[model samples]
Target: MNGANHSSGNIIRLLQSASANAALYESGHLQVVRLGNQLFEELSALLEACGELSLIVVENELIIDGRPQEYSLFINRFTALLKARGVEYLKFQKGITRQEVASLVEFLSGAAGEPGEIASTGHLRFGYLTVAAGGPPSDSKGGERCAAEVLKELSLKELDRFTEIYRAVQRRQKLKVSGIADVVSGFVDLFRQEGAPLLILAALRDSDEYTFTHSANVCILNLAQAMALGIEGQQLKDIGVAAMLHDIGKLFVPEEIINKNGKLTDEEFDLIRQHPVRGARYLMDIPGVPRMAAICAYEHHAKFNLAGYPKLPPSWRLNLCSHLTMVSDFFDATRTRRSYREPLELDQITTMMLDMSGTELHPVLTRNFFQMLSDLKTPS
Candidate 1:
């Protein structure tokens, strides 16, 4: 109905047409060539418009971009074809060509022996969905699970791990950077498999889980932001780790003061403000910890304009990772309900973030963050 849905449906139609033609005729036949050309043109236009086109198979459904399409003969056959080839996900980039489309259709039609037999090109990529099976029992017939369930289970496990890590920190134990890296790596894989940012973020349900839950949410948001900026590999994981530990200094602050519902005395507030420096120092002492983690922990509250706590020299520039964590921190903090205040609506939070852009937040990054949110919300 809408432009996004229309484009998605059109692409699927062209793909089905091309694959059907390829199955009936040779790859170089006139009809197969025409269908491949049409499909390539459609995919190229879609990629140019959206930057990337991701087709993910979640159980029995086909997810184009982030939205699952209605079940149809075309979708059913295509899903079966991909499942037969052990290909659960396909991403098309801007430089995809007609020849690549032909090859893809040929592979889908069983002309190619296996997925690996046809090496993925630069502009076309293939991946298999690795859905976690440990989640609660599925309600759907046949017991098939969905992406949201997988994310929730993984998020809860990560939260439990972070809770233990925080308690260890409170007991003055050495921080295990390897454990943090493992959690970040899991999140990166989850983000890659799951296309929707909103769906990847863990919901904050219980106030008691605030400390670790906030950390998890911030880590997810930071990963989404980093990936949107084309950051990948170890750099992406480092940013995620930085976000996870950004508030580690709060562990040193007394719980009574940290969770107090009433206004804090000036001394209490001052102690609260010292968390950044304290967290940074603690991280600095840990071997194998990413340096960016310490920097982010220290500068997350240091406003973009250098107007917020633990004052640094005006000439010093903030680390980009810290800037990212700061934005995520503010977003998750304002959105989650706390003892002192009720959670704000999404509209209010976005408006406030916009108002603080260029002052409390990096202007371009702030806008980019919102744009990412907008894209996720758009029907695809």
Candidate 2:
């Protein structure tokens, strides 16, 4: 017996306690596993002599049967491998509180995105609680992105709609400000009414191309903001067009700039900075790309404090969409990695956004946006 087995309590108790919230926990295997009070501790090599078998350590005890010794060796070898990579040893131990287990789903979402396999077969078989069923961290995210793409491909209607919306805003440079109420309303309808299906979107979060996937993420953010403000109907339709095409400007920037391997000079930086206005001008010709989107292109970079680029008139205040887009844009950009920097973790980003609320974001809207994001992250 290991010191943990001899000590006061072990992992089994912790796991069993959390099992009350059966939706969050599952007993992965069986074979007379008994645990201690502290589940997180490591107790191995005991199995090496016992031979091989399927085994799992819940919060307190060691459950083992069938080829127990080989199973022990497998675990020991696995521990060594993970340790070399800065990973801690073995099954999330007993020390991990019930709260931590619940948080695993959200933490995994950041890792898996939408196409992740958060749930084991056991979880699926035993009715688990899903945050936003089929949303990211579930099986359907990829499908959702595909559906959105399919809709984009088949809906010539939006193309014509965006064309008119695009031209209307170009005469002046205010960000497709016309018919936007309608654009946002439609954006609301897609998810709220169309039941646009969240599982598909969840699947993409798990795909290989995470940064590109941020595009759909941003669209969702923008859409949510539009709906919360009650901008519906034709106005919603226009917003959806604007939201979907907001990044169309990036098509013009060099891939090197987008995926640069390293830091850039002031000149390179200036060129990079031009994306918003550049995005605006590029869409100037796209008949279907909404001018509101074009405007978003120009003004999305324009900060609420009036410090961002394309320095507009002194009296100009950012529109609601532009202001909302600012947070979404930065959130997506910072959370994804570049060759030079690792992605900023979500908790860190959440903390940073708190400062920009009044200065860069629409205050109330920012609160709701953060709330939605936070709620989504809380384990189901």
Q: State every prediction's TM-score relative to the real structure.
A: 0.61, 0.48
* Whole-model lDDT values for every prediction: 0.76, 0.48
For 1-380, candidate 2 gives per-residue lDDT tens digits of 34434231222233333332332434432211222212222222322332211222211122222001222443454323222222221223223343344443232323212332233232111111112333334234544554556455324454355555544444433445344444444445557544433322343344344433565556666666554443434344555555555665555556678777777878877877877777778667755555567777778877878887878887774555576678777776676655678878777887888888777765655666665554343211
Q: For residue 226, what is the lDDT in candidate 1?
A: 66
Query: Residue 196 lDDT in model 2?
Result: 38
Alpha carbon RMSD to native, model 1:
15.0
Q: Which stretches of candidate 2 lie over 4 Å from their true place?
A: 1-190, 193-201, 209-212, 378-380
What lDDT does model 2 reach?
0.48
Task: State the lDDT at 100 in candidate 2.
Answer: 45
Q: Write the per-residue lDDT of candidate 1 for residues 95-204, one digit (tens) a residue.
A: 88877887788777764354345577998888755422332232332122233454465655666777788899999999988888888887787666645544555334
Candidate 2: give its CA RMSD in angstroms.
Answer: 20.9
Candidate 1 lDDT at 166 equals 84
